[model samples]
Structure formats: C-alpha cells, structure tokens
Target chain A: MSGGAERRLPGHYLKSKEMYSLPGLVEYRPVARYLFSAGQAQSRFLDGLKEGKILGKRCPRCGRVYVPPRSYCEYCMAPTSEWVELPGTGEVHTAVVSYISTFRERMEKPEIVAVIKLDAPGYTKGGYEFAGLFHKLCNVEPEDVISGRAIGMRVKPRWRPPEERKGDVNDIECFEPVES
Target chain B: MRPNIHVKNKVAVVGAGLTLFRRRMLETPRELAWEAASMALESAGLTLKDIDCIVIGTAPDAFDGVHLNGEYLADGAGGVNKPTVRVYVGGGTGVFVPIAAWWHVASGLCRTVLAVAEEKMSPAHPHPQGVFAYIWDPVLERPLGPNLIWIFALEMRRYMHKCGAKKEDIALVSVKNKANALDHPAAQAAAKITVEDVLNSEVLVWPVNRLDISPVSDGAAALVLASENEARRITDSPVWVEGVGFTLDNTHWYNRELGYPRYVQYAARMAYKMAGIERPWREIDVAEPYDPFDYKELHHIEGLMLARPCEAPKLLKEGHFNRDGDLPTSPSGGLLGVGNPIAAAGVMKVAELFWQLRYEAGARQVKKPVHRGVAQAWGDLMQAGTVIVLGN
Candidate 1:
C-alpha cells in the first residue's frame, strides 16, 4: 500500500488507461426468445398513446381505475374488470435533469425527465399511486427541475403526429405543464 | 407442513463451487454458470441426472444484455426440462438461490436441487454503467444525471455522519477485505492494501473512493442442496441451512431515514428467530454482509446485528472485523475485494461460509473455529434484504 496524496490509487491509474476491461468468463445464450405476457399490457398502453388518449383499467371490486392499466389490482389481489378512457393529463410528481446519457456518458445537452401522477378515482394521499407514468419533460427549463418547482405541477401529454404514430412508448413526444 | 411458514423436510447444502473472479472474462454468462455448476456437482459426487430441480439467481438482465435472463441462462444452469425457478433481490439473489432450493427440497417436492448464480457485467456495450441507468427512477431520480456512485456516496456520508466514522475508519474495511481477498481464488480485486492507500485512492464521490468499492466482474457460483436424508447420503460433511429470511420495503427510499437498514434488521431478526438464536451479535461466528461498497459492509454489519449500528466502524478500526479478529467477517474477502458479480457475489459468500463451517476453506479459513455463520445480501432500490443462517 502506497502513501501520500500525490500518488494515485491503482484504480485511478486503471481509469486513466481509457479502457476499463471486464472479464466474461461465463458463456450464456438463450435458445428461444421469451414472449412475456407483459408485452400485451405494454401494447395496450401504447395503443392509447397513439390515439392521443390515455387509458386505464378499472377494478369493479375496488372501483379504482389505474392510469397505466393493470390486469389485476396489486392491493386487493384481484383482476381488473373494466377499461376506462381518459384525457392525457396529469401532474408532475417529480422531475430531474440528466446531464448524462443512458450509458452514463456525459452529454452535450441535458434531458429532462418527470413522473406524472394522472387524475384517478381513488381517495386519500397515496391513492394517486395508480395514476403515474414516467416520461420526458418538455417546455420546461432545467432550472425548473432543480428548484423543486417541477413537482406537483400540472402537465399534459404531447403526442406525435398521427401519421408518425406507432404502437410503442415513444408515440408521445413528451409531457409538459398545463398553463393553469 | 404449512404452505407458507415451514417446509415438511429439512434441507442441507451438500456442496458448493465457484470459478475464479476476474475483471473481465471471455465466457458468456451461461458458460460461467455451467463451469460452477459442473464443479459443484462433481464435488458432491453427483451428476445433472441426479438433480430434480434448478434455481437460478442473477442481478439484472441488463448487465448480460439479455432480457428475461432467467430463461436465457436456463440451459447452462441445468434448468432444461426441469422445474426451474429464478429468484432475485439484487445482490441478495445468490444466497437466496440456495434458500429457494431449500424450499424445493424441504417441501418434499424435490430431493435434489441445483442452484446457480451468475453475472456477466462485461457483456454490456458501453460499460456496465449504461445498465445502471435503469435502476434510477425514470422521472425523478434519473433526471438528476446522477452516477451510480451518488447513492453509495450519500449512504456513506449518512453513515459517517450518524456513526461519527471518519473516512479513515471506514477505509479499514477496504484494506482488510482486499487483504483477505488476496487468498481468494476467484477474487478479481484482491490486494494487500492499507488504510493510507484507501485514503489516497481517487474519490468517486466524497466519502467513497475507487478503493472503497468493489470491482465489476463476471463470475458464477453454484451449490447443490438436498433434503437432510439425501444430504447425508451424498456427503459426510453437509452444511445445514438452519434458517432463511427475506423482506422487501417500499420503494419510497427517500421517505425513510438511512442511518440503519431496518429492512435488513427485520430480515435478520426473522431468520434468527427461525434459527432459534436469541442474540445474533453473540451467536454469529462469522459473517458476510453485502459490500458492493466498503461502507456498505459496515452498514450491513450493523443491519445483520453483528455489531451495534454505530459500533461497527469503531470495531472495524480496531481490527475486530478481520479474519483473525474475535469475530471474523468476510473471511472469504467479500465483494469489495473478491468481485461483485452481484448475484453471484452473494452466493459466493454463502459458499465460503459452507466451506468454513466444514473446515474446507483450506488456506482461506478463519483463525478461529467456526460453527455458525450468516450471509446477507441487500439489493433493489435499497429496499430488499435477504439473509441466511447456516451451521454444520
């Protein structure tokens, strides 16, 4: 073990080499592609987004319509029965500005992300839990995300043009604050 | 006999095996799993034909660049044409695999179970750091442009603030674990380190430096578990799984205080209760708490009830957590020194305990005799705690 502030640790030297090599000793490969059941749920959600409409599933037993529809109620442990269509609107529960890209590499421009809590029929403080989705934030400055002002701000989904619409998550351009 | 509470039969880990931990490997994830599983089966004098079920544990599919990872690695783990179950709780998944295997055997449903945990962090395209992106909250947390180190740094800061621990005191863990890992065969980051070296290490975030963290590596570990009767029939020195506990807290991580891991404490309490241990701090002979980062080991040491919440750092500074200390912790060198294959790392710790309990640790044995040991793995958005108590 070396001493002194001037001497860098071994890891620092390794970092300076510009190559962080990781060993891949194991050999794993998938024989078949797995078609997860969750894909159906995701498809349904995307379909709603393409139509510029937000959809939710209502549990007859609990009478709570989840903004991002679920096949079953997580709490009551029962299946959801009805599908409800609603406007693409909600409030930003929280927001952050990311200076790094998805790969953790520094980016030239930062991207804004937010969690929107959509309007729902459940009562109480935590009841709004079912009404949330994660997406990009637009028409908002990065400073707004840092100031603690982005949270609880009303926002609405901005969809892509109808011609460009696809049955995928990116169908919506972004979500921005309502001028309330 | 109850469906949820207890199993009809007792389960024992008959054998365990692991490949060398390395910073990088050419083998894909399945290859690691196969090598480890093959070794474990060989040690137990059994073949895949003897196995009745399979259970796998891996941290994240993103690290391997494969989604639905359980099925992806199934064939290598010997899960083909068998009852296979994959369980994950972040780093805790390794130990949890055996726990799951125990249930399969203890339920009288399977006589022999093969459990494997593998992680291939090398496969990620742009460094595994890209994979870490998904761990953040897509809306709130991800937007902050935070590095994975940010959370660990925050935790280390909170621990130091609450426990009155200095960076030097916490750095002792890094030194000790690295030194211990020097003897570990699969260790990727083992070194003869000193506290000064740790202090001099590059600071990733304030309290946490490069030395204070574990290396990202690719590795796999496997264990063969069986019912008590089958265990005795297979091996003379079987390590019994005395107790298992797992608990998951809400994801509102920021809502709760961070000084102590109540989730880990609760999980340990449950396992201890099942093991008939009244006082864990005194009963546990050796321990391996999750140490993806150095302070995490100390933080988990307290969470495992091995020491008073704030006393671990002090005890650590005094060399009480060393292999030759009164209570050896992470005699296998731990994740910080060995390697953090995530799920595989946790299982590696459990395997070390099994070796220690049976006096099969060879050169890596603790200075003192070991009778009872605990291995705990923590994961998720800092919400999952999984623990296993073992004995000869």
Candidate 2:
C-alpha cells in the first residue's frame, strides 16, 4: 500500500518443512504452563455435570438463564443468585462436521458439533437470548448433518459413569439424539 | 455514540509504509517493525526525532512466542522514551493503531504521532491455529476439541442459508480479490483464477475451501499521523482523518444471530454520524471492509451499509463493487488477496486508502474520483468493530 511492487516487500518466504533444514534458524517450543480456574458459577455447573445434572443461573431481572453460567447477566447486569437445574434437553440450533482435530490432524471418524438451544421456563422459542451449550454430538452421522436432518433434532447429554466423573464438562461424553 | 465534537486539533495522515506480507519471513519481529517504521518515517520526510509519540499495534503473545510484546517492540517502533502505548483488539489492531494515534494529535497531547502494526505468525511452531485454540472458553468449549475453521464455516453456512447465497456466489469474492492481488507486490496468494478454481480447491471444512481463506502471514504496516498545522508543513496532500469509531460486542458469539454483524453496523452508524455523512451507501466514495474470509467481505459490506442486507452478492455479481464500478471496495486486494498477518492486514487497507486518496497508487488505484474513503476491521471472536473515515 505504501511503495509500489518495484520497491518490493521486505521478507523471505519459506515452506512449512523448509525451516527445519535451513541454516541458522532457531527453533522454539513454548514451555509455558497454565493453571485455569473454572470460577464459581462454572465450578458449580461442573459439579452438576458430574452428577448428570445440567445447571444454569437465572437472572432475577431479565429471567434469562445462562449455561456454563456467569455470575451476572450481561444484559441486565444484575447478580444471578438463583441456580436452576435444567432438564438436560435442547434442539440443535446449528451443527457442523469437523474432520480435523485441534492440531489439524485428520480424524478416522468425523465429529459433529452443535450449539444446542436448551429450553427453560418463560423462554420463547428462537429468542435472541437463550441458554445454549457448545458440545460434540454422538449417534449422528456426518451425512445427517449434510442433509440437514441433524439440526432441530431434540438431544440430551450422555453422561459418563458416576465413578469416573471428575467434576468436568467432559463428564458428559457427548449430546446424542433423544431417541438414541 | 457520537464522537467528541470539540476536538482540540484535526488529524491527518502524512505518510504510510509497509513491509511485504509473506507466509514466512526470515526477519525477526523487531526487524519487521523497524523496516516498516523507517519506510513510514522516510515517506513523511521526517526523522525519528520529529515524532512526538508512538502507538504500536500487534496481536497475541502466542503468535510471537514472546510475552510482553509491546515492550519487546519498543526499540523497533521508535518508542525508546516517548509515551508509547499498544492497543489491541485481535485483528482490529491494524486500524485501531491509527485511531489511537489520531487521538494523540487530536487532543494536542502530541503534535506528531507514529502508528505501527506488526505481526510474526511464522514464529509459532507447526501452525498458528494452535495459538488460536486458546481463544475459546476453556471450561465449556475446549472440551469439544473444535477447529478454528469450524466456527467460520458455521458462520459462512448460516450466512449462505439466510441470504440464499450459493457457494458459487461466495466463490466470486475469492476470484475478484485474488485478481486484485495480482497487482499487490506483497500478495502471498495472488493469482489469475476463476470461480471454478476456488470451488475446485481442496476442501478444509465443508463450505470453506483452501483458497477461500487467506494464507497465514508475517509482516508489518505503519502510518505517520500529524496535526493539521504540522501536516500542512510536511505534505500538501495530507489525507485527513474525518472520524473514528470502535465498538465491542458481547463475547457470547453463538448467543446472537450469525447471518449479519450487528456490532459492525453499530460502529458504522457511529462513525457516519460523526463524519457528517448521511446515506453512506450513496455518499461514501470508497470502502475497505475486512475480508479475512471471502464471504466476510460481503457480510461486512452489508454491515457497512454500502449495500442493503443480502444485496451484496447481487451487486457483486453485476460488478458494482469492482475497481471501476459504482463503489470500489478493497482495491488493495485486501486480506483475502494480499495476506492476513492479524493486525497488519487492517493497517494495510487504511494505507491503501492513503495512497489512493493521494493518487500516488500507480496501479492499484481505483477508477472512480475518490473523495471520502472508509476502512474498517472486525475481530475478537466476531465481537469487535473498528472504523476510520478518511477524506482529502
């Protein structure tokens, strides 16, 4: 944008694999460690997951429920003091099939993920604000997602055994269709 | 929100500069910043001593593999002792750099400001997407093991469904932007390709093709901002900064509708009001909407109100947004064509407008008689919108 192509760009181009063999190239790997706290609302929600219960916090002002709940409502900005145990059921608002993992490695079997719009009392269907969870979907094939049959299908969480639970969101293995 | 109507001084862009954008760079991050900073200073006909302050814009520390990046880039950005500050909003940092510099001069705090943006994505091992994996909510989303492209693909698919736009319609953006990039010296993925080339490219996710995305890049861009009095002494053709606006929406991206960017609209309205321009679709002469993805350009076009909702694709198909069309957008090949170095990409667009408004862009200049130009950047989980309007 500043100088014309005549001045040329000021960098060298290298292929992904070329860097290893290049001379004088210093390779670095990050060794930073992290200890994350799930915080109060999320800690309580994880405990509910370990017990096969889906929990949300209800905003006293807006009556809006939040999953993976927050301590306060973003809209109402009021403290959420009431804890609501949800029915652990919702329909898929949107879904996608991922063939790659976090590292860009191809998977043997694709995973279907979705934003499940969880139902709550006094909540209108398809409102802008609603309780939702981002999770993996089981018992649903990739083809089902492509054909649009997976979306809008009611689903419930399939929890891990209580003995194996670690008070984590993964305690629920994946959300599968109600029939499944 | 209306910007402060009683600003102390008007700000103008006296000069701009950029280092070539490439997928991998042999130069270190500091070196990249220095190269761009020097070019910008040289263009303004001023030495480093003339600058009163420095504003640096860069993305995450993970990309550079170095913590305290702002401090690390101090020497390169000429911020040795000057009041230096780094402003970041993910990809929005590019344009936000100048916006930060504008206030420095506008407030009479600094007579001259140097704004620089640099990103070193190549330093990250394997791929930078691993760094982006940390952007998600660790408690709820990390457990799902989602790929970065999955969210973009979901948004693309939703936009396609709601707008009734086909994959072919979206492919046109890739074709147009890449062709425009053919003239860009720093373009990493520029080519003379057809829509079939985009559709036939390797598919990463269902709706996202390899060509549909911008290449990972490492580079830097910079601009020199001066007050009205200082600018007149430097260049006779200074591009004035008319107005600036930024808005950050809620981080709960999935909680809202995916078809349109409501945050961008809010930001655009704020900017247009302060710029004293009504009916941006008819008044604004040129625009550079953020285009990290092909569809994103069209999505942002609608958000900018350059075209009506779900009307960009139709206007695009008719060549209304071309270099010679009614409204020329992204004539600099944009991030889709040039490269995406996170923060540097947005600065590149604003720099392009600087050159175009001055009629100094030899080949990349649009055909229209330009006057008012708007540049915008969207970032931070699709939650941030930053806009700057410039006129000559």
Candidate 3:
C-alpha cells in the first residue's frame, strides 16, 4: 500500500526534431474559415459605431446597460428592451503593454491595451461589474502602464475618419486620454 | 446557493493514475487515455468489465486535432457499450471530469465510473498559441490579434495593482511549485529554479515571463469513482468525495473586476457549504488551486478562501504554503512545475489530493497530518471555476 516505492511518473518526452523526423508522423494545417454573424444587438451597435456613435443595450427590468450590447441581460435574464447612446468616454478599468504580437513574435512597437469602463449610468460606481470595451490605448506611453498611471485614467474613443469608418469594432481606431 | 437535496448515495475515490506529462509523446491522445485508464483499473483491482459508466474530460478539440474527442476516446476510456459523457469548461475540464463522475455514482445511477482527462497540445502546428486564437470572440476581441497570454497578463497586472503585490512576491509560487515537481514522475517542467531565474526568464508579456507560465504539455490522468458499498469492497482506504461545485461567469470578462475570481468564490462557497465546512482557512489541510500562471495560484487561493483576500502572497513569503508549511498548496508542483495538458492537469490535482489523503503521495506528500483537502481549477474566458473537496 506504500506509494513511496513507486517509480517515477509520466510518459517519454520527444524532441521536436525527433518527432518530425520519425516515419509515419502526420502533420496537418486546419483551414477553419467562418463568417460569424454579429447578432442583432451587436450588429446595431456596430452600425452605430460606423456613424461615430457608441450604442449600448439597456435591460428594462434591471436598467443595466451593456456596452458591446447583448440582446439580453446576463444578471436579470431579461431581454434588453432599450437602446442607449453613450458619449464613448470612460476611465481605464485595467491596462497592459504588450511586447509580443498575437503569434508570439516580437513587435517593433509595443501596443497598450486597456479595458475601458464606458460612461454608462445603470450600474453602481466602482461596482464588481460594469459596461466596458476592450481596445488599444493611444497617446499613452508604455511607461504610463508600467508606472500604473494608465489604469483609472479618463479616456475617450479616437474614431476613424467618417469616410473611412467601417461597421466593426475597429471603427474606433483607439482610445486616448481625454484632455482636461 | 442551497445544497442539492436529491443525492441518494455517497461517492468515494478508490484509485488514481497518470501518464507522464511531456512536451510530445509517441502515443496518440486515445492511447494516452488508455494507458492511464488501464493503470487506474489495475490500481483499483478492476477492469473495463467492472466499470458501469465512463466520464471523459479534454480541454479543446483543437489541441487534439480531432473533433468529437469524447467519442474518439471512448474505447480507450473503457466506454464501448456503456453510457459515456464528456464535460468541458476550458482548462477547468480536468476537475470537472471527476465532478461529473461524482454525480453518476452519487445519484445511484451507476455503481462504478472511470473518470479520465487528457490533453495533447503538441498536435497543433507552428505552435499551440495559434490554436488558442479561436477562444477569442471573432467580432470584437479577435480583431485586436491577442495572444492567449494577454488575458493572463492583464489579470496578473490587475492582481498586482489591487493587492499591492510585486513581481518578486509572485515569482515565489513558480519557485515553490517547480521545486515540488522535482519528485513527480510525470512532471515535464520540473526544475530547481530561483526567483532571479524566474524574473530573468523571457518576458512574453509585462508582469509575465516564460517561466511564469506552465509549459504546454501532453498527458492523461484517470481516477476510479464508486458508490460507498462498491468503494468499501474495492479498497480499504477510499477517499470520500465530500463535495463538488462548479460555476461559470458571464463571458464579458473585461466588464468585470479582474482583481479577484468571483466565479471561483461562488464555486468554492458551494462546495464548502455542501461539505459542511464554514471555516476553510483552517479546516482544509491541503490544497491545489489552479496555477497555469503563478499569480493565478494566489488569485485562486483567495477565491477558495484558503487565505484572506490579498493575504496569500504575504503568507507564501513566510513559507505558509510550502509542503512543510501549514496548509501546503500544490504539493504536486501544480501546472507550473507539473506541466499543463489543460484538462489533464486539473485531474492531476484531484488525484494528488486523493493520494495525499491516503498517505500515498510518496515523496510528494505534505508534512502535516491531513484530513480534508480541496482541489480547484479555473478556465474558459475567465469564467468557469470547478472545485472538489476530498477527505480520508
């Protein structure tokens, strides 16, 4: 019944070269393409962004507004019945500077990312949850993030030119600090 | 939430087994499952013929490069004609596997269940990080081109900012878990490392270094669960399943406070209540909070109420979380030192606790006399929290 006498655990480790060079080793690249439908609420929100406005869905039962609007409220489980236009300004909830790109490759210029808690009025101030958007932060130095100054700073969306605006989350080029 | 009133039978863990955690293995995913499952049956003095049902847990099909992986792994998991089910909640799938099996036996629907979890992250070409891209929302988050580490880094920053914890304090977890894994037979990332080694490691994201993360791994873990009567017949020292709890938060992770894991708290509260444990900080003797990232262990410790909010780092500094220290956490080296095959890693934690309770952890056992222990896993887009409480 004693387990101390049991030998070491785990399977054998295979080196990359050893694995690839081995006969009968199969490799495949999946071509998974999809045309995802931006649901009704998100579609309307995207269209609003194309016109340089931020739209949120408000739940009639809970009066909670969701930025990046969903058709229903997650807390109340009620269908969102109202559309509210926000000023597209908010404070940074959290932020980080990325030194590497999505593919794990080093980037020439590091990007600053933050979760912006938008100026929606339904939820309590400094609550556990909020209506927020995740986007890049511009006009902010990477040192601002390392120094912990980027978080909780007021900011506004820097929208792309109206003529170049696309019906996507990218319509807002990046978020920038709102000048006093 | 109140306790469920429908349970008619008690469940006990009779045997547990694991395959070696490695970067790449010659065995296919199913073969890995079969190896672990077969060992578990052998340990419990049973075979596929004695199993009434099977529960399989794997993180994502993308990692294994196979769809319907549960059905694909059924035969290896000893599920041919028997009823089989696969449960997934991102990385939480490992602990959730045994949670699902606990229900089968506790409900009196099955006499014995073979709970198995496996993950093979090596199948994805280039790197598994490319496969991780699919977890993000295509419409909103995907446009930003996020690496999977971005979210962990963001959460780590928030934890540091909110709790007044520094990077040095967090590196201690990496130091502790990897050293713990030195004795683990299945460990792939186990090493003798220092905090300076962790700090000087490659920085993938600010506040997260290469060593701060668990290495991607391929492995499998299996456990045998049976009703009280069946467990008594199978083994003299069956670890009882005191309680199981799992919770999923809304996917709008950015909209929530990232400082603490509310989902994990909810799941832990449920499990503690069902186990009749009102004071977990003292009652629970050992623990394995999910630690894919070092800070996550601290985040989950507070979530599981093993330590006061923001108190884990300070306690960890004083050796309160070491194997010889009080309330030792992640004695199995956790995901950081033990290697993370995602779901299999979680099952490994549960299996560690079962062994610890039975005094069968060998060199990996904690120093204190252990009675009740808890193992937890957190995953999905910062959503799912699965917890299981085990007792000898």
Candidate 4:
C-alpha cells in the first residue's frame, strides 16, 4: 500500500493444452542414467544383505554404528574401522501407509512403509542418531498404523529366498513384525 | 557458539521483491528472476549499475530441467560483468542467498549485492515429484520406490506420536496460513479452509492429505543488500541483517530421530547468539518459519525456539500464531498458503520479514510493534536448516 501501488495482480494462468500449443515451446526428454558405486562401506553392507545378514560400520573414535554404512563417521569425522554384524531386529521407529507408488500411481492394496531402527550397541536408548533402514513392512495391519500400534513395535527383516537373493537393499523382502 | 571473527562492515536489506507464485507461468526462469530483481532494485532506489556483486540461489537443476542454472540466470539477476556466485543447500538456498550476500557486504568486499532466488517446478515431466526422486540415494532409498511425501509422512507421524497431537491439531496451521494468504498478492493456494476440509481432502499418505501440503510453484524473489553506509544513503528504513546462520546435518536421515529437528535448532541457536538474543520466545516479535507442510511449521517453531518443545500445538490453539496475535507467525502467509518454489519460498519468507520490519507489508503487517523478526528454511532430506534474524 506504500507509494500508492497495489500489489495484488493475478498471474496468468495456463491450461495444459494452452501450454503445449504455445509458440517456441521446446520439449526434450532427458535420458540421464547412472551407475552408482555403492562405495567401500555400503558395498560390504549390501554384500552382507545378500548373505542374509545385516551389516553396520562402527566409528572407532565415537563408537557410533551406521547402517547403510559410510566409511567415514559423520559425527567424529574419523575413519570407520570396524564392521559390525547387526541382529536385524529392532523396534519400528516410524511407520506410514502409502496408498500411492513413487510415480503417484494409486495401488489396489495400500503398502506399509517404515523406518526400522536395527539393534546396534553403539548408541544409547532415546539417542538422536541410530542405525536404521527404510523399507517396506509386512504382517502388520494398516489399522495397526492408524491405531498407533505400529510405531515402537518390535520388527525383523524377512529375507528373500537364498537363491533369489541379490546384493541390494531389496535382498530383504521387507521388515515384518516379530511375533512375541 | 560465538563466531570467531568480527566483520568490518554491517549489512542491511534495503529492498525486497517477489513475483507471483503459480503452478505454471508464461515467463521462463530467467524472465521471472529479472522481473523480481528489477522490482527489488526499484524499491531500493538503486539500479544494476550500483550493484557490485550478485548472489543467486536455486534448488536442483532437475526441477527447472536446466543445467548450470546459476550461469543461465546470471544476466537476469544483474550479474553481467559483475562478481556473481550461486549457492545451493537444497531448500535452504532461499535464506542462504541473503546470508551469502551478507558476507559480501560485511567483509567490505562489495558495497551492494543483488540476491535472487528462483525455482520453476513445472518443466519436469510426469510431475515434479518424479524429479524429487533424484534427491534420494539412488542405490538405497530409490530402490524402495519411495515418493517424496513418504519422508514427510513418516516425520509427521513421528511428530504426532511423540507429541500426542492428533491430526486436527496439526491441521490448524494450514487453516490459519491459508486464511492469512488471502491478503498475499503472490499466493498460489490461498483459501479460507477449515480443519474439516483438510481432514476430508485427498489422502496422499496416511497422515498427509492434499490440503496439508503446499502447492508446487514456479516463482522468483529478490533482495537488495548493502553495507551500513550504503544502506543509510539508499533508504530511510533499511532492515539490518542482525545475524545469519546455516547448518547441514548428516544425510543418513533415516538413522536419526525424526520427531525433532536438531539441525534447525542448531542453526537457530547460531543466529540467535549472533543477534545477541538470549530468549527468542520473548525477544523476537514475529517469525516466518518455513511451512512447506503444516506440521513442519510447528516442527520449525519449536526448532527455532519460538516455543518450548511440544508447546507449539497448544499455543497455536490459543491463536498465538495468528496475524493479530502477540507473536504473529507467517503474517504474509507462509509457503503453505503462499506458494513454495523451493529456494524462492525461503527468499519469500525473508522478504516478508523485510517488508514487515519496514511497515510496508500493507495488509499482512502484524498488529504488534515489531522490532525483531526471524525467518528460517529447512531443506535437503531433512538435513539443512538456514536461519536469518532481522531488525528495523
């Protein structure tokens, strides 16, 4: 309202068809592909996944364990020198029911996703940092999530068949509830 | 933590401007940058000739589908033949833009700096959400086939569970922010909505409905920063950049607790200490915490120490965060109501504080006599936190 100028002028709205029909509109699809090296620590961790085992790197200086292991400790900035085999069983840190896929495509049956805090000995209880993995959850009803029963519930990774295993995060089919 | 060295000259934001936030625009990225930069210079009573340096901030190149976005936007940002640099810290780039410009003036390296931020999320095919896939670790996170909202949903769920807050409690932020946006000219998704509307909206993830999230926007914002001497010569009411702080946490986001934003808290502490602010909750009069999602505003409000941990929801219910409240937040409508153009959105928040401090915000100005204000942005796999404190 200063200087007698009004700030509200609606922007030009464009329809999809109008945008496509505009003159000098250039559309080019980018085909960028990548072959990411899982790196020193993560490579070993993924290899362990294929062998039906979970791996974490422990910082020698600060004794912090990292799943999806990094060669360098983020906190202590020291080289991670020890590879620790984890129990692969931990409580569900957080969980959500995903009704859609990566591309925003709706699925017939909603999928349950969660961050599983794998049991590692480095950090204390209620610590900020932990050794965790992001994966799908199974054997838990969607109602369990809506009712606040899924979070903090004990869970373990359900590994795929030995012959069908691959050296990737998906080697473990998904994390499932550990029946008490 | 106190800073190591003292800067030779003080910095001030003399002018700020922003283009309309929309889903799609006729103008290209550079054109949007130029339009906003021109407006900022005009408001500052300066021209490109007076600018000695330029700082441009933009999110991933994948969003705009243009590589080297900084060099591409140089001319439009008035960087032609001037010392120009582009800074990126995921969504934190918006507030980081002015923080970088502050150094240029405070170091006595430049008399005046033109800072610009722009993001165009429309060019990405399928949807901009598809481009966001690039932000995840290709080997680990992408293999899970996760949408960007999955992270936010998980974090929101964690916040809800830890705070014992229901969906209705979090929905109030969206309702309040969208209603405030009714006065924002550049707002893209401004509406008079109720908590029921938010609950009934299309459910993307379990807890995050369509109404809880900010719209994908294409827009630009700019600010003119000058040394104290140059600022006094250029304008009568230059908003001083009292402090600037930014921090990046480890990228192993899943390995950490999601309920609290430790990174944002660290950054806010850094800025507050530099500003000589002992108690942010009582010292700061207003704030513009990034609200790309409704719950995020509450998360950041606590991280910024504007409220005690888990106290934002209670305060929010009592109209403590409204435009007319004692400590109004996001008076210019935050990204939830205004548009979220990533980097541009953060710049827009800082720009709102600049306008509010000068009492030039017109209808969006808070009722309280504002002397100190804070703006913050969070970005990059929930790792980056950028904060700036300003005063009239």
The TM-score obtained for chain B of candidate 2 when compared with the true chain B? 0.98
Best by DockQ: 3
| Predicted chain A of candidate 4: TM-score | 0.92
DockQ for every prediction shown: 0.07, 0.54, 0.66, 0.62
Report how far residue A86 has shifted in candidate 2, in Å.
2.8
Misplaced by over 4 Å in model 2 are A1-5, A15-18, A124-126, A161-163, A178-180, B1-4
Candidate 2 has an interface RMSD (Å) of: 2.2
lDDT of 4 by residue, B1-392 (tens): 34554989889999888889998888889999998898899889898999999999999998998899999999989999999999999988999999999999999999999999999998885578878778889889988899999999999999999999899999999999999898888988999999999999999989999999999999999999999999999988989998888999977789899999999999998899889888999999999999999999999999999999899999999999999997899988899998999999999999999988888888888899999999999999999999999999
Candidate 1 has a TM-score of 0.72
- Where does candidate 3 stray beyond 4 Å? A1-5, B1-6
Overall local distance difference test of candidate 2: 0.86
TM agreement with the true structure for every prediction: 0.72, 0.95, 0.98, 0.98
Q: Per-residue lDDT of A83-154 in model 2, one digit per residue for the tens?
A: 999899988777777777787777877778777778776554347557888788899987777667776789
The alpha-carbon deviation from the true structure for residue B50 of candidate 1, after best TM-score superposition, in angstroms, is: 1.1
Model 1 chain B worst lDDT run, 10 consecutive residues: B137-146
Tens-digit lDDT string for candidate 3 (B1-392) = 33565688899999888999999988899999998898888889998899999999998899999999999999888988899999999999999999999999999999999999999999886688888888899999998888888889889989988898999999999999999998888888999999999999988888789999999899999999999999999999999999899999988899898999999999999899888888999999999999999999999999999998899999999999999999999999999998999999999999999989999898998999999999999999999999999999
Instruction: Give lDDT tens digits, candidate 3, residues A1-180.
Output: 233226555466789988888789887777768999998999999999999999998888877888889999887889998999988899988788888888788888988888898988655543888889989999999788878888789999999999999899899999999993
lDDT of 3: 0.91
lDDT of candidate 2 over B54-91, digit per residue (tens): 99999888898888998999899999999999999988
